[model samples]
Target: MNDVTTDHADPRTVRLLVALYPARYRAAHGEDICATFAEATAGRPRSAVLRECRDLATHALRLRLRIGPTDPAGRVLAGAAPVALALAAGCAGYFLLPQLRELVHRIRYPYPGLGLGHAVLDATLQTAYTVPWLLALGIAALGRWRSARIAGGAAALLSVGVLALTGLYPYTAGQMATMALVGALVLLAPAGLVDVTRRGRWEMVGLALAVALPMIAVDRYGAQHLLLPVLALLPIWLSAVAAPALLGRLSGGRPDRLRAAGVGLGALPWLMPLAAVAAFDRPARLHTLLQYAGACVAPLGAAVAVAGAVHLARRVRTTDPADPA
Candidate 1:
């Protein structure tokens, strides 16, 4: 009789493969699977070990989504933080920095003009500033939580330093604070709280596009015209209201009243710009419109954030089993 011993299979490798399963599944059957694999493949070909490892990974992913559930609040925060942080970085680098540089040059040179050198430098700086956040997002998508946290933290710190050094703090303190909050959420959230699944990646992409497309359109088509900027930003305002509701529905969790209310309140930031535009006569230039819009949105964003915190607290209280009934 031919023996099927797995002498060729490394025990350490077998254990590592078993660890790929979900936490619950590993706790339940990890040791048994490891032992069985070690015994059954004692003299088997290396191909058998590879096949088993592949199967383990597939099953692990399926079980992660099916059995090992995650908190909806955590999932939403985790999914949203990266997109918000990336947007913050991109805006600071691509939109704010060049303008600040031009202002400095105007003061120093007494005249300023767009030149090939300046354009190249601007593009280079923009790319440099944007790359770290992109890398962090990519790492987060792969479920490399630790790496993502490190990358995000580094990027946030870099942004803070740049803003402080350039004397742009007065203009961007609110944005910096928002970036800090997003960084903290990414770095401090518990393991498995952030779902790095394919669905999670798509959600991030959708949110990013929701924010980005309008900004791009405004910059390209509306920045030089009055009323056009307002029109372009209208989609962003609409998205702010729609995104949370859509995300909540797709999260696959039971609907909670507080969460819904929080999401509704969170949309207030987008509404504030529209309200400001309505209250005042149309601005003469694009910059004035943007300035007023930003001023209106920042305070409202804070209020909505507070509401979101209250919602999170309520969710925690409801989910906690040890609390007194």
Candidate 2:
């Protein structure tokens, strides 16, 4: 066919969309992709065309991210994914309680100050932000891959609308951002990375409970006992310190690079709560203990990511002189 489409679709836009794929991919099927894009979106509305474009870009970006099991980022993700899911699930579960409690309180009272309107809004927000994480994690852990993706992607989009509608962006930005990242991870993570054995799936659920219960306890009562907080931080600490070395040893090579990168990615979700705790719950002594730990860790995690990128660049250069393979 000619470079231009007779069907009113913009040829230039079609070319740009196809260009987002890898050069190898482009070389193989670029023309067909462009043609199909043109044909499918030819008579669609602007919104539909944009949606198609966004979907194409997203898939292209996912490919560029090197989400396969072999790459360093992919490896780190595979290692960190379970932790991310569990922590996200735990965090989501923890936050859900207060919202439920508040909703109940508002319903029970229905006082002048505590209107039914407030209860409705809080319930909607909770459903939007908190419930989806739990749902996605459950569905993913149950090995329902398509359902997990749908649950996560839809939830993330729905939460955006809810937050925007409620006009509570400023107040809930941090929690919303954290939860949104979780949804994004669920949506974008490779199936190879997340689809684990039945035992592994159960372990993920157990870890989620391990994270959520202590956190819930700490929230319910003051930080009077150190054991609770210690238990909460234990999974992160063990995983961060042990996981990299374990992975490195298992892989049977120079484990330092893997270890370094693992430290950063692995510790991230676990440390997130500590960062918040350190900020608002400074009175808790655990925050101070974690404060010193984070200071040492923060720099290392940054270095690991930088180091991984540099290393990958060198590998790509050696493997494919023309372009990334």
Candidate 3:
């Protein structure tokens, strides 16, 4: 006996349920899903309608990760980001090796090598800004070691410390704020840090606070000349850290080199605006920063990405495996 009465139903409740799905997915099945919800809740109270809305959101997430049909394009894009990042890091390491080696040689000599000391310091600065080693470390901690939760929690604290020390910059973008939230969420998941739950959402909230508090405090107090440009940075750094899995998701089923290029090119739009800002505002300084940051961050992203790709690939190939990668 199915009893759904029209008298207790409200149409507005069904409309909100459609917002959960990714835009492409939503466009296809949203109508059917909402229609079913409407039919089932025809005479439900306002509170019941709200409950349905909550249920729809949860269902959409479940479908995205576990049940829904896989999107190959999404996977290919996801895979390519790490590959590109890895390649870039390799090139940087090739160039930086000589300087690092010379620095080590000079450090051993009886005389103090001021030039070599400067070179080492310069190399450190270069590596830190461009390479994103810390970002990769976080990814590896999450994906491979089964210590993502612990790693993420520790990183969260360190990130706060970094943000606090660099109080000279403004945290302007909503996207940056969102990325921090995502990072926090990633940190708060079980020691594995894979599942998305209410606790996960709270983790995101905590991360947002972690990032936001420092930015607010710094901007309110005083300004300092930090070597790394803060405003131009937080967005990319946060995005890279928060959405590390995006590249893997986009790489699709057995994505090849051309597909990888396509994915990298696709990411250019979001990148172009930042590049433009860096170019116009501090062209020479930006170039120097990019060089240094690239050297450091690229290798980190590569190591983690290759590890993840190998792990995921192996999982896809076998039911039971001796090693993950």
Candidate 4:
């Protein structure tokens, strides 16, 4: 283990040499790296701190992907929003974006007046618009009626309409309905939350029905029309099921009470827009996701980064006042 010491060595060169971590991480580690650099430099400058930090950050990313998650604390420390957004974008871009392009070609190339950019923009907008509508319909079905006679009836009707209009029977609307249904049951905490438990079981049934209707409709309607929506809903359904369980473990309640509470609280922010989408059948897709990313994720990421930055900034803050002539 080598020790570090502070001594002159063309401080600018020393500072310039440590600039290789991601800007945010680099800024945090520069001083410490620089101090180590000073020791290694001895009476002369060393030139590889920048390269070293880059390797370190890259290695860190690899380690994260390999290590099974321990708790939400580990995630919180790593920055959850960026990680989730990156993963979502990766999955969507890989799967959905190309199909969306084909849909764009079908709509725009039909007419000659539009520019290439306009066609792309139009497709993006349409896909984006549909997300909210699906979300809205789901919430309305889940929230408005609780009985099999009422809730299932309403979900069935809406499920059919969404399937017809979107050309997929259940779609994201059904997925949202499923999430709401699960969340509602969790709220009930059946057993102790007996009524809620029963309702949750029903909700699961509703979600399954919502999901099922589209598959049946697709078989009836054919694959080209049905496939895209199936792609979209699969992620949401899986996420809805898995997220709560993962969140519960992260929240640290053996019976999952705290996990349920945290999820309920976290979910409240999206409720209004999500509910509105369900009620109105408006598509808020990419826009809603973007809004969540911007309003929710970005700010949180910034706040964490800023806090870290400020901590560094305080250390770097000048201790001496201006010197008199």
- Top candidate (TM-score): 2
Please report the TM-score between candidate 4 and the true structure. 0.28
> Please, what is the TM-score per model?
0.46, 0.59, 0.33, 0.28
lDDT of 4 by residue, 1-325 (tens): 1223323455666555454344665567767777775665554323344444444443344334332134332233222211121122222233333466577665656456666766666565544434332333343335332232233233334433443455423334544454344333222221121222444334333433444444445544665655345443344432343243234333332334333333333323223334444445556565764453344333233433444555466556766566899
Clashes of 3: 34
Write the residue-wise lDDT of candidate 2 on 48-137 in tens digits: 777788777866766677764556666665555555666666666776875687778777777698688877767777777668868877
lDDT of 1 by residue, 101-217 (tens): 664564455535755566555545554455677677667667676688788877767655554544543235544554565565555443455545787566555544555566656
lDDT of each: 0.54, 0.61, 0.44, 0.39
| Clashes per candidate (backbone, < 3 Å) | 7, 0, 34, 22
Model 3 over residues 1-325: C-alpha lDDT tens digits? 1243244444565555576577777899888987788776667765666667766775676455433224443333333333323222222233344355555665555245466566555555545432342343335423432343334334434434444444423232222232233343333222222322444333333333333444434433532654455444433433343333334433455534433432343223224334444545656678765664464345335634774677688777887656856
Over 4 Å off in model 3, which ranges?
A: 1-7, 12-35, 54-69, 72-280, 304-325
Model with the higher lDDT, candidate 1 or 2: 2
User: Over 4 Å off in model 1, which ranges?
Assistant: 1-83, 86-125, 226-247, 250-253, 256-325
lDDT of 1 at 59: 56
Q: lDDT: which candidate is best?
A: 2
